[model samples]
Target: MGNFVRIPAGPDQSFDAWIEEPPADRFPGPRPALVVLPEIYNVNEWARGVARRYADAGFVALVPDLFWRLEPGQYLPYTPEAQQKGRDLYARLDVAASTRDIGSALAWLRARADSNGKVGVVGFCLGGQLAFLSGVDATPDAVVSYYGTDLHKFLDRVPQLRAPALLHFGETDTRVPASIAGEIERHKLPEQDLVTVVHPAAPHGFSRTGYEPFHAEADARAFEQTLSLFARTL
Candidate 1:
């Protein structure tokens, strides 16, 4: 039970966010919120499905269009052409600007009448990288990252991470090899509660429902771990 919401990102700029909220009677009071960052494919049907699933599980979830600056409401389908366009948009993305946009979403969630004021974040692929960045910068209460590509590129920022994080990576995925993932596991920030796991025999997009590399077992287990993290932290 959700709908599209307009979120103000910056001066004269706004983005569309797919917002999902559980039935009010499902719980006695306001519920926790989650900001779901989409992959390079933008906030398509699959991304919206993730928000719906979170809402179904008793959370208020929202997925913002990270590419809003480039194109206000872009939703590219899963196709070769769209992949190129998505990559182009990704290459042109200003991490700092987009992170600010995410910060706006977080503020919006906290101010909602039905929110408990606790917010967590989960992201996949490129969004996964943003989840880590957001944890370090936006300061979400909890962060879950599923196979964030090129995550190692941001290890320098880990020391500043202000929240607990749970990360999953596919063991055989070359995009983020074992060596890089291992480095992340070894690096530690004084009080940062970070957990990293490697999904045995899984690939890059293992958690994606209808993607070519989707791994059902791995996806289910990863999702369970995410839920557990949120339950305990948020």
Candidate 2:
């Protein structure tokens, strides 16, 4: 319960992160680990609950707030005001810096008390892209992406992702068209460690709990399969 911890980033003009750990009481043994990266909204209750769900299933999960770099204490996509603020902040974000911050989270967890050194990563929306990109450098054993946008376009630069990866997509999601997904599949490495699913009748963010776009059946199925994927490869 007291697992919600904040770790400051580099002292020299760097960002800080708000992270949540799974309930220690749920995990009495050394467990495989994962870093739960939040969507553009940062670490909201949905993301925290999802992290706890993973922890409850015998893995240690940590969620890092990626937006803290541009605005401390700022999380988004809840209030219209917060959403606008997050968009404005994004205009000023240094993507390379945000990527570095993701690396920092991985490094922190690798040596932390709760970690078992075996690591995986999972994320939603923008965070999903980070999860995929991090596989190139974040020291994860596997990665799960929930409708990561623009990822197929970056396959050349992101060609080095070595970990097993799973991607979930909504059939109705225009943000990431089926064509792009096809391109991604075509470019996958020889390991062939990629699985992408298009859930029928689901749209973007269908898995976002408590959101209007949430599709109960699709979310349930997606989550069930996603957990299965992570459980196997994490």
Candidate 3:
């Protein structure tokens, strides 16, 4: 369970976000926060479920509506039509503006009364790219990227990433084939704290529950790795 909130993004602009907070009795004081990025499906049930998962794990989770610029409050279903529409929106997106919204979301989390002033970002699919891009803008405590596609485009900014990062990839994913992921790994700066994992027998959307490629063992391991990262960094 979460509620919608408006977070200021830019000059005269704000976006909708889904806020899931941990139970007050369980977490009486400020708690660590996480910015959970959704897939191309936007902030639908699956995305909200992720936010809730983080809440149940004792962290305040926030899911920003990444498509606010073009279609505010629009939640796309998991269908062919929705996928095409999401791809269109993703293609036309202004990278600069999207990163700004991410910065705003992180800032909002840090300033929340219930926040412990430490925030970690975890993203899936398209959101995975945003998680990497956030390093170029905001220096969050930690970042976890899952099967992010087209990361080769942001290799130039790898040196700017200051936080510890855990990147997950499915060995069988055609979208981010081993060759491409290896290139990304090669670009990792010597000083950057990064760990890259390639899971065998897993596909593109292995972490997603209802997806055909969903692999429980791989997803659980990935999540455990993520929690360990945040535990040490956040």
Flag clash pairs in model 2.
Answer: none
lDDT (CA) for every model shown?
0.87, 0.74, 0.86
User: Could you give the candidate ranking by lDDT, starting with the highest?
Assistant: 1, 3, 2
Give per-residue CA lDDT, model 2, range 1-234, as digits (tens). Answer: 424566546776445454545566766646677888777777777777777777777776777767776666565657788766766765676667776777777777777775667778888877888888887766688888888867775878545777788888888888776565677777776676787777888888888888868889888998888788877875
lDDT of 2 at 132: 83
Q: Clash totals for all models, in order?
A: 0, 0, 0
Write out the backbone clash pairs for model 3.
none
- The sequence of per-residue lDDT tens digits that candidate 3 reaches over residues 1-234 is 799999997678888999999999987767999998888888998899889988988889999998898887768888889999989889977777877888888899999887889999999989998998886687678999999878888888877877799889998888877565677678888878988899888889899876667899999999899999998987
Residue lDDT tens for model 1, 37-117: 999998899999899889888889999998988876778889999999999999999998888888999999998887888
Clashing pairs in 1: none
RMSD of each: 1.3, 2.3, 1.2
> Is 1 or 2 the stronger prediction by TM-score?
1
TM-score versus the correct structure, for each prediction: 0.96, 0.88, 0.96
